[model samples]
Target: MNRNIKFDNLRGFSMILIVMGHFIGTTHFTQTYFDFAYTLIYLFDLPLLIFISGYFSKDNPESSIKAFRTIFIPYLIFNTFWIIFIYLTKGYVPADMYLVPGFGLWYLLSLYLWRAFLPTATKIKHIFVISFILAMLIGTVNIDPNFLSISRTLCYFPIFLFGFYFKNLEEKFTIKRSYALLILIPLLIGATLLYLPFNSTILILKYAYASLHMGNLKGMVLRLLFILISMIIIILLNNIMPSKKTFLTKIGKNSMSVYILQFYFVFTIPDIMNYLGFNYVFNSTFLCIFYVIIATALVCFILSRDKVNKIMDILIIRVTKILMKKTTP
Candidate 1:
């Protein structure tokens, strides 16, 4: 089947943002930075990716099997690999890495949870509203993020629902690109300027107000604002996003490939650079930004290649077949 250029492009766009965020964070040296760009990206990148996940979603009970095949199986394989890799490299692995998930692995587990429950979830009327309430409510309890990625899963659920509902929008939604840009650009600027380092945890939705040293009332209010603003950002992005073909189209089409493959590089690049006596980039924001851009371009270029995607596709298919054969009558 032919892929949607726009969808792939958006995935590419989101995937790059994910890379940019992680690259900036994990490499953090004297670049021990928390500024507007980082803050702003954290606010929407994962949620946007989750929304994209739902755009392709269907209300099918059988999708749970698909989720098990694709999302769950890959997550288990990678999670185990990540654990072993960390054990060898870092000297100790987390006891709950598989159940709790690491930073990059959360989305895969969360997506599996979302996909597995989707059919039953869709049957509930007003599920979007319920999901939003759940997102807000989940923030009240300080659930350790390492525990199943449950906090993020609930927090991002409504945005995913919005994307699902958006799939059926038959001209009910229309906006001028000029207008969307007018709204989005200012909002982006406002969000950037308004962001602070301490506020970063709220963006991830992984902790309670107490855990963040915020009052419950204020946290709830801000959380509500974050969710609404993110929706607006996504809607504006949809209206303004270009449909024309570009390199990002291929990157976006094979976005999951870029996503999983980049994990191999995100933490290593900075360390490799630092060990080579190239610490200058970490000292200056400009150099750091430039470094990440070059790194991001390289990752997108190499990881999104057809051959790499084919290999991953083949691996997932074979693994799924094996799992099915072992379990089925």
Candidate 2:
């Protein structure tokens, strides 16, 4: 029906999938199964997040400025904190890496860029098709991934554009939700049968095709396929999902917190689980799957709490506000 709950549910669920993806990759499980499971989750998780974000995107200067204050500032803070954290904990000198994004924080920068540029981008004719072409062709270049997050910015921009366009598309056309499932079911089955070689890094989208040792033409084809599939999955799931307030609703509402804090869990949770006898107990693939889900749910629950969100808002958003106010000219 007419409710935000559906979007929140999707966001919450996708966010959990994001965390579970991290868990399954790192936690000891049958290597074969984990790879497949990770591949399956990643096929659409980040796309879903991007789509949902674009669904709410505004084409205005005010919102763009706000994105800088809210998102870019936090991104900078996150990078700085990580630099310090790594040096202190691992004795790694991340020299002159200030402009680079750290791990999950790239999404923050991407979002800021989208807010800033997508408004102007929307003015271009056939921007959607152009975005797809750019997303595919950009991988053939020799640009570094972290240099202003350039590669990923181009790679994922199509999905972001689709998200922004979908809102208007739906308003004008009556979409048949049933048809989406008809296609999605067979689409998933065939994809699963293919069992493409996937890892967390590929989904992160920071590497060039050359970096991954993939032929440029072949990599472009694969990128196109993945983008198409992700678009389908994002559309179908949003249409089919129940629009009701539930466990995931709260998490969705606070999904940003879960996203930002998840790296902490991703890196440490496996070790903690191992020390607490997780790896010793969950031997089978299914059992490890169960454990990872439970662990991710618990972490999501904790991070979704109001207190945690407020503290993060203070650390990220509030701090940004303070900085912005001081620098306002």
Candidate 3:
């Protein structure tokens, strides 16, 4: 597949935001500013990532299997790592260790689910429309949080399909950077302020659940608005950013590594900080933001190395080959 620099840059940018979001979420916060930043990041970061993954997904006989290995295998491996990390660190077994995905690992499971289902789902005409309505309706269902990975998968399925089918939409036009900024700046600010009233619920919607306090109708309306707003923001982001070789572009190319490996740091850093007596210094909102930025860069640098890629290839590629052989007979 030919690489699209614009999408690569977008992916890289989204990954950083995701890392930052996780970092912010893990902090023990009583600060309003930290909550605000975390909410803003949560609003669109993973949705954008899911959409991009769909955009890059190819439809082929082996595509599902390939995507499964590429994503799900790593998820299993890393989730196991997380389980061990938790047991060693906290000295207790979390009941949902195997049943639910560990922090930051659910995306891989969701991605695999989307890819596995998309081939058949995309065959129906007006699928995106149909799937979106289903996504909206899904918000009304009372489901267990243990079912979250699958619930969120079904909810975001429309956006994923939209990305695949709306290929031409990406290049339909480009907005001037100045104009894009002029529009996006005020739009984001206005949306943030308007969304603040429901900020508490808006944060949980990212988990693909209806707001506990809001009615189903209101929840559906707000969820749809989030979908639209997220799409617009991602469009403007892709249009306005420089689509050339840069650090983010480099990070984007190695996104898989960063995505898979960054969770360890995000989950462990607080304890590490506390152990080192730097918790007081690093717990501030500004310092947490700085920590997220530096940590993202460090993760990208460390995981993008050839040695790490080779190790990943061994796990994903080698296991894939083995599975194929076992199934051949």
Candidate 4:
């Protein structure tokens, strides 16, 4: 209610994590490092995002409507553009256009679906939670792609609901010492799970496989524990390091534009470097990291500038406003 410093900070943090996860994912790395980082990304990246999304849901129908315009419209527009880009560049749209490497707009598609259903979802929280857990159970056991979709939908719904519920709770529940403890407990649990070894023979390649192999009881427990850890870290960070009313907040506010546009840099910048002969200049691991760091910072800084982002902000708002008016009664 009080502008939710925690939620805002968490949103910004999650966006950065998602971006970094993609960067790590796309770069050529040793198997051990990739596997570890990929596993962590799998465990918390999306759940944190969905939780932040839910946190902002609150009780406002208008906000939900705006979220639809902001998330869904851009998702469709960007997806279309990417489809065309792929066709022109590669002569065909890639089969996994939805899974745009380093962009992760597929999450946007999934988020859009959840936002559209939030109205009905908010009304039946327990039913949604139960249904989601059951679906995850079924998906894990059967190993069906359709079931995987259902499992993800179900898993993230509770996060959205938790966000909605927390928005309300902020009014009634003050941040106390106990609240901090509640956050820490789950983090510790998650840390233990990550460190502890399980039977290598039983481990699965896919995330769903790992969950299924863990068995319903352990899988649900681990997943719930991880979600709790993520939520707690978000809350704790918000309480400790609230966003200052500064440039980062402005960037965070316009994060979607930054998000949508960053893909061009992520996908094409390597090629651009190759063309410019920077790739040959920096071929080693240290140089590669330095190059990525410089490139990413340059992209973020350029996009963070007022002139470019202001124009984008104006265009997006005008377009979204028109769509909102048309969609609304």
Give each model's clash number. Answer: 1, 0, 0, 2
Note the Cα lDDT for every prediction shown.
0.82, 0.80, 0.74, 0.58
The candidate with the higher lDDT, 2 or 4, is 2
Write one digit per residue (lDDT tens) for candidate 3, span 8-97.
788888888887777766776748777677667766787778879988887776778777777777777778888888889889777877
**Tens-place lDDT digits, model 1, residues 90-191:** 899888778878658888999999988889999999898899888888778877766888888998888888888888882566699899899998898787
For model 4, residues 168-236, the per-residue Cα lDDT tens digits are 576444466567667656664566457345432121122464543566667666566555555566555
Model 1 misplacement above 4 A: 29-34, 326-329
Question: Per-prediction RMSD in angstroms?
Answer: 2.1, 2.8, 2.5, 5.0
Model 4 TM-score is 0.73
- Candidate 2 at 267: error in angstroms? 0.7
- Candidate 1 residue 114 Cα shift, in angstroms, is 0.7
Kindly list the per-residue Cα lDDT of model 2 for residues 239-284, writing each as its tens digit.
Answer: 6777878888989999888998888778776677678876664667
CA lDDT, candidate 1, residue 280: 79
Clashes in candidate 3: how many?
0
Task: Assess the local accuracy of residue 276 in candidate 4 as a C-alpha lDDT between 0 and 100.
Answer: 85
RMSD of 4: 5.0
Give me the overall lDDT of model 2: 0.80
